[model samples]
Target chain A: MTTVTQEAGAPFGAAPPPADGAGESAIVTEGLTKRFRGGQVAVNALDLAVPRGSVFGFLGPNGSGKTTTIRMLLGLVTPTAGTHSVLGLPATQALPRVGALVEGPAFYPYLSGTANLLRFDAADPTAPRTTARRRVAEALERVGLSAAAGKRYRNYSLGMRQRLAIAAALLGPRELLILDEPTNGLDPQGTREVRALVKEIAADGTTVFVSSHLLAEVEQMCTHAAIMRTGTLVAQGTIASLSGGLATRVRIETPDTADAARVLGTFGLADVRSEAGQVTAELGGHAPERINAALVEEGVAVRGLAVLRPSLEDVFVGLTGEGFDVDG
Target chain B: MSTVDTSTSPGAGSGVRAGEARRTPGLVPVAETLETTERHARPETPTPPVPSARERWAFWRLLGSELGLTFRRPRNLAMLAVIACVPVIIGVTLRIVGGQGGMGGIIADVAGNSLMLTFFALSFLVLLMMPVAVTVVAGDSVAGEAGAGTLRYLLAAPAGRTRLLLVKYLNAAIYAYAVTAVVALSALLTGLVLFPAGPVTLLSGTTITMAEGLLRILIAVGYVGAGMAALAAIGLALSTFTEVSIGAIAGTIVLVIVCQVLRAIPELDSITPYLLPTWFTNFDAVLRAPVDFGALREGLVAFGAYIALFGSIAWARFSGKDITS
Candidate 1:
């Protein structure tokens, strides 16, 4: 019955980490670390601050400790060091309010989808039993799983299983919903179905922490994103902010590529590359106008020019040298 | 605590609900109650006072579900079939062979008195089948969940790890008791039809009436079930260490068997009372007319000690484990 502990400064204790001036955070972790036996560091000194009501993307490649980090945040895995809180309470207490689908949804293969939802709902000591029937129906209906409610889980397609797991998360009114690769192994239609559901859930004012290895999925679904690599967080912020830090190449096509390259080189822009009649350069702080003006001043015919912004996928590869499985 | 979605934004089903929640007057602190069943977006129903953690755990629904899952499995039914067949085989063989060699001469009595069949079945149930069956059930309860990828979701439920472990253990215990009772009941029925029904003589050389003897058999059935609790704890303890149920089940049986082998060695007689399965074999000792509580008492102490040692280990391991699956 005594859920919260005061040892080592509980993360929710009037701490600045969890406070969000614009909106309260559903999760906050300060240097959270986990070192498994045999001296294997699974997750290293993670510092996370997830704002409430945002669809936060946890982006990392396979074996990057994304699931491990989520487990630690959900209290399924205790941290070797550091502290975390969910919804302004210690992990132990805040976790109950969090509904998670870690590494895909797992349920008794023998039970019907509806029965599994009921079983999970009943497991929550706080879930009221009287309205359980209504809740189950609503969850299934909302997830578009009402038809498969009577079907056994083993018989469900990967998509149905994922949706059922989402229904399990939706069985109660949750403040924070943590999904780790909710779309893993799903077909395109199933992936789209799940993405729509996540948006809906987040729209309901629940802070969603969704982890995935797909950059395109994160770009499409998340308002904010955090990238991890080899068990450590490399970068994190709003999708816009993370996108802002990466370089946007200035591409130019001209009849005289050599002249353009030489004139563009006057600005000393980083990484200038030229081929045939086109030239591209990472004009970090130089205005596209300045590059164009310099080229025109030197009598280079500029046929076309554009400032191309980096997509989230480009930023992802730049941040972690590994290209994500886009749209999969 | 309760806010029905009232906003009318385009594509506003979830939007309205969230807006209502953020703007709702005097919402219950998020920490107090997890009142999150989205109820038809109707604002008329009064918010129910959410139950405390203690109140939630008190609901028997969780135990019922686990019990249903464990006992309803095909493998569990197969185990019950094998156990049920034990009593039938004993009864039929005793009726045909007309010999009482098993259990040091209790088999012959099983022919005339159905009540003594429980006693005849005791050595087999306690020493072999009960422990194995219990290990399977208890071991599979937690580790199996982990392997199936359900433990991560279950841990995030409102219940704490301590409570989840308790519910799982209790469900397996119920299965243990059910298995023991089924065997005793089967033997009793087989003895009645295959042989005659009359008075039963306890191993202590005292005579008891038929009705009292039947009552004693029921008590023995329950008592044997109690003895199996130690094995359940061992199975659960082993379960917390691995995601594979077979590993836990096999590990439990191996550990218990090693303990039994150690107890059998004359050199280890000094520590005989500390063995895991020694008290397990004492299920028959309680069937005597003047039931001796000394052995049963010592057995209970040993059982409690095993439970405490292994139960705490399970809690500690589970509390800290990082569930990658």
Candidate 2:
């Protein structure tokens, strides 16, 4: 279902339907590019498809164009090149159905939390005024900010601000909610709160496309992920697929290491390394059961076997060619 | 690397499998593939139609709220207090200090006619208080949102760029008119109580009845208000260009001062009338017995030109800007 287009460098027009079809995708971008006036390439030829109802993690380092892409998706920034659609509608036409918080939540500091949400919620012309009061209160309650609803936003701590931002996005039941670095600048407790909130949001069957540079953030919250580096998408897929593809090792323990190596060789498993009576191979298409079954059939004493697949961090670092811990 | 409790989390919980080794390593772990209804993902609700009338009503409602917030701010209230004090100062000074001495301007020259004191207050109101009021409200209209990080929400609200800009302009215009009204009404009240109500001498050295004088005062108030509206538009444009509200306000004030200085240059007399501040004082023409519609018309035309020019620039800049801040 990967629809990485060839004309990604071209300007935005009508993008083709996602390979999985439009109804199944929450968001689709083709040839999405942006070149700032100072010759800086903020986003370069990005093609991203987010499936409906999944918590899609947009992973990248700082300055990797995560926020820029979110802006383009929300129609907040006009893309210098390419097009993106949300829920089968052009991004502009799709705005009403989408709820977005970019970078972080920006609200009137002079206004109280509920007041800020009220103003923002009112800006959506589709929201009926009669129900806004209850919706605003419920939103604050869900984010655990109901107690602080009367407090001015300026007085809110970083966590409160982040929660309130999420509440703003949840003022209604949106089909898609785009949050850019939702937990950014929050304390650990705040991060956990926001993470739980995101998890809870996804439970309601809403497609949440959240962006974060922290691998752990995505690892803890995403069902599917895409990694970007220096404004270019490097890898994307279900968490298992992305983790399964790179830097993974399979460890097999047996007394006859040489015979085990010969057997693996016979099985056409290249790059089998033997040490300390154990044979290791890069985990890929080869099934571990087949290895065990062959070793037993060949009369090699198989003591134990294990799959030491690469950690998600290792795959991230390998894909981006930079230390994954870099906060950006 | 993550140790999240799967029961509490939503998407990222499925991990390490048992030793059975039946599932492919590249498959979707234990995480739910999400909802089963992807085929009907698009809701059938027709796209929300943004009716123009609803939009227009929303614009005004937002403007009202914005203005309400401004009126409640200590800084803005203090500015209005100061503007409201001008007529008081003019009335008290003319009553105590000017006694029977004839001052130069139309109202100050009479000194005792309450109708004329309204005219005297505009001398100070038009130059300092009016522009400051406009600057305080308009210069922060767009920039303040960026500074507070609220512009992203407003734009992302899909408050169309042009519509949001229009709303902001109208918000500042409300403040401009409100400030002008505060000054004019205070002056009118001061004129009535602190001095005698009678026929007032016009700038052209002709006497007009008290009713005619009040009518001219109303027109003069509108004239000053129109002038402030022009400055508000300039402030809005400047606000759109910067994230610092202080910078936008200071920039607009500086531009006005520079324009005034430029207009005062004797060698630039040909261009003096074209300057923004030149039209502000044109309300004096309203005090003339034969009312020089020439300068008043010129002043309004200049105001319209300033609003159109600067307002469009704001819309263009704000619409195209990336909300990184």
Candidate 3:
């Protein structure tokens, strides 16, 4: 499936076969590593497989090698060791079909938004020049920047610059879109719009590999995610699968904490603890309703109760052992 | 051009609408057309059946866009404007000081014939001002993009590393020629309007017709342009080393100034032939009655050697560089 002949006939401009055995994953990296000068390991031996048509969020903290890895994938930086492929082809060969926005939006300050896009479009050897104008217009429109298209990039607000960067990635019909911190400077409403845009792009059958330190962004928009700490990948899987690994916690608020703890202990829950006026335990396959019913029958006087399923934030914190910016 | 042929083909001709339709379920039409386009426009070598004109146009398209960016930059335009004004200022100053007691060398010759001003200005400016202009453009070619963080996007646009390097070099070369032409034209116009126009006295004491004098000026323009192009190559090589454009620009200027300082030292005359600055004034060969082709050719060869050496250095450094910027 990794044979050259299969990829050679397609070139980069051609659409990658969506359901073929060779194209099942939009991106696959094996032991991809990058060690900078002075012996700084920015990215350790990491393996990543991003399924096609899935919105995969690459979650990591600042200085966690997310941008460095993206640079390597785009051939902007040479890897220290290992190999990677995009759309089942070598990164350079597959780059024409891949649109990327690394770090942030950058353009000639004197050039208008439209002009900057035109210059970028000209850079891609595969993009047809005949329809370049229309594609640039459509891209700007998609990102809701058509009104500001004629404005100089220097005059754009941070959010507009972020949107323009996304628009640049959308300039062509791409098989894979790699956006690092896509919503970094965007406001809340702008963030929501970008999230919707990602979902829209994913729905159109394009694989999206987005990197961000915002835990809520990944939890809300990503189907699958990989978490990185320092220079190593800590965890990776579908969002549900990752969250599923953590136990569901049961918290009950009552004046009779000791009685509630005894009651919860009777249900065979794990780590039952009573402190102050609160009793908490790992639900561990126990139904919330049944526990609530048993507590009432036992006259534990349950005032408030919450069966909390751990969010992706908790999963990330637990895996990396460091707090993340859960709000963006 | 095959743009007319292939673009008008039944499937590929429908341009914008087909592209717009691709967003929907009509991906097959766009995909089929793109495959056909790629089949014809294969990288490096177009298939044998593809029209040569289209291939040539594709080669120039990227270069054209690059040239547009370079020329449209206000900073570059301002530099060129300053270069143009240098000849005007020199010509006007020579005109006001016509036959003054201290007037000597090229200034006396310029006061006698209008066309001599063009030659004198080329000799005067090529030393530092012209090289500075070319260096600013060439040095900033890659590093400017790096500084502004646009180089990453350009490369990821998959502008092949080698091709981008070639385009940057060409862009700088074109600007170099433009700088030379601007100084020559501005000086020629300033000279003609201010001084008496007549047969030019050559360095060999032979008089040449106005048409021949203009031709000599054209030759000097080209020679100086070549010399500046060589300097541009050095600037480009330095550009590949750093993300700070000013560093590359200043480094190239400093190298040129150092060479000039070395050339001025009579004790170091043995190393004069190897220095780039020593050959820049070789355009003075045009001032002789029968142009000194031997000297001009030697200068050109030196320029070519400089270009080759620095160009390869730029390619090797840039192709393997980690574009962290």
Model 1 stretches astray by more than 4 angstroms: A1-23, A246-250, A259-273, A281-307, A317-328, B1-59, B99-105, B259-268
Between candidates 2 and 3, the lDDT winner: 3
Q: How do the residues A43-150 of candidate 2 rate in per-residue lDDT, one tens digit apiece?
A: 999999899888999988888898889988877777999988887766765565677878777887778998898888656544546677998999999999989999
Give a tens-digit lDDT track for model 3, residues B1-325: 3233344445544444444555666355656566556646644341221100112234367888899999999999999899889888998888788756578776788898899989888888988999999999999999999999999999998777898899999999999999999999999999999888999999889999999999999999899999999999999999999999999999999999999999999999999999998999999899886889999999999999999999999999998999999
- List candidate 2 stretches off by more than 4 Å: A1-21, A247-307, B1-56, B100-110
DockQ of 3: 0.23
Candidate 2: tens digits of C-alpha lDDT, residues B242-261: 99999999999998888878
**Residue-level lDDT for A120 in candidate 1:** 85
Q: Which ranking of candidates, highest DockQ first?
A: 1, 3, 2
DockQ of each: 0.23, 0.17, 0.23
Worst 10 residues of 1 chain A by lDDT: A9-18
Query: What TM-score do all the candidates reach, one by one?
Result: 0.81, 0.82, 0.88
- Strongest candidate by TM-score: 3
Model 3, residue pairs in steric clash: none
Q: How would you encode candidate 3's per-residue C-alpha lDDT over A1-328 as one tens digit per residue? A: 0112222223335543344334478888899999999999999998998998889999988888999999999999899999998877678877767889999999988999999999988887667688889999999999999999999999999999999999999988888999999988778998999999999999998999999998888989999999988889999889999999999999999999988999999889999988888999999998898999999999989999999899988998788777885453
